[model samples]
Target chain A: MQINSSMKKSFLFKSLVDYLYILNVGGFLLLLTTISFGFVEINVIKGGDEHWSLLAISISCISVLTCIVFLRGVYYLRKMARHLLTHKYFSKQIIKCLKISGTHFLLAGVMFVVIMILGWIGKLREGLFEFVYDINLMVPLFLMIIGLFFMIQSEALLVAKNFKEENELTV
Target chain B: MPIIINLDVMLAKRKIRSKELSERIGITTSNLSILKSGKAKAIRFSTLEAICKALECQPKDILEYRDS
Candidate 1:
């Protein structure tokens, strides 16, 4: 069967979605690796054993949660895009993915404040290790909080609008 | 299977070029092609009206029903 131009445009959009998901996957992997590195280094710190354990535990938790979100998010997006190509252009699965990813962003925001307080304490003390979270972390955390909310609201709006209701006639 | 666009017949009778019709109708030639090929699922009333007005024709002049 011959394909139409509109189908071609739709495929292009799917490819874009695939590329974005690949980026998300790569970012998640990078985060995991970075956190593991920190975890290992923290375990090796002298006179900061307890603090290191706490930081390691928190970073590991964040990494695990982020990976779960990233994997599920990409899975849903890929499936949703394939379904859209065969049929129409909307998905509840995609909306769910957005919700999970948005929550991940919110966690990242909170992680920032925790790191900030620890970094300030480290700075005021002498002979502390070079593993302190920077005070400037709060600004970026605030930004991440804003970003997280944006994601949450945008997805919520899309799900609420439910373009399928507006576009496709019921069978 | 139900739509048969008579765009060619209307255009020929009116001596209008596809490019000119598209410009007047504010649609791309590619979209006009879709209409002409009867591949479009639907056309907006505004766009149908534009085509009729530009070609000095009626909706019946541009659209037909073909039993599948």
Candidate 2:
């Protein structure tokens, strides 16, 4: 079908699942780097002191955990898609995860923007530099945030339905 | 809020089995049962349309309106 990529038949959930999985693993790596090397390097390269380093570490922890949760949700989504006629506990989990991850991505985006602004403003206060980021980098982040919102909405709709369909099928 | 699905009535009138209707409608027998039992929360326009077409009736033939 022309809409396969946009439909459940094409297993679109795999994309979100992949994103969450990557985020989890990448976050863990970042956490490791921050602890093992970035801690030392940031002070030299970015002029970010130990406090910034610690905050980076904390955010990494939060993101890694969130990504893991979202990835677990991915498993449930795939399961539900494959078993359209079964109403089980895992189905409920999929819906719950959709709601959580949807909100999670949006929140993460907001937090990122806030932290970037604060980081820039903090630099401005020091009179050392101004915030000068290429527009390209910021565009993707905003687009990603918007995509997460729509994904969450659409996935949640799929989850809410079919209980009745499953019920009919089972009976 | 009181939209009654008249699938049962139509099936009774036609002397058809749920399994037969499901087969015709391309759904599992259990799901057809669920629809007949009024346990379904929502039905797709396509599925409902198929049922209506197969039964040779309008949606109102299978779905009724009442003040709830």
Indicate the worst ten consecutive residues by lDDT in candidate 2 chain A: A81-90
lDDT of 1 by residue, A1-171 (tens): 245776887688779879878887887778668866885343422335555555455555654664564456455556556665774434555555555555555555555555555454544454664554567655546646754764776576586656445443211
Per-prediction count of colliding residue pairs? 0, 6
Off by over 4 Å in 2: A1-27, A30-34, A37-40, A44-94, A135-140, A155-171, B1-68
The stretch of ten residues in a row with the least summed lDDT in candidate 1 chain A is: A162-171
Please tell me what DockQ candidate 1 reaches.
0.03
Question: What lDDT tens digits, residue by residue, belong to model 1 across residues B1-68?
Answer: 68788999888888889999999989888888877886676778898888878988889888888888
Q: Tell me the tens digit of each residue's lDDT in model 2 across A19-112.
A: 6566766766786688687474434225456455544555455545545544454444444444432324235554555555555455555555
Error of model 1, residue A103, in angstroms: 2.5
Candidate 2 docking: what grade?
incorrect
TM-score of each: 0.38, 0.46
Superposed by TM-score, candidate 2 places the C-alpha of residue A59 at a distance from the truth, in angstroms, of 8.2
lDDT at B7, model 1: 93
DockQ of each: 0.03, 0.16
Pick the TM-score winner. 2
- What's the TM-score of chain A alone for every prediction? 0.45, 0.52
Residues B15-63 of candidate 2 have per-residue lDDT tens digits of: 8888888888898877787778777767888888878877887888888
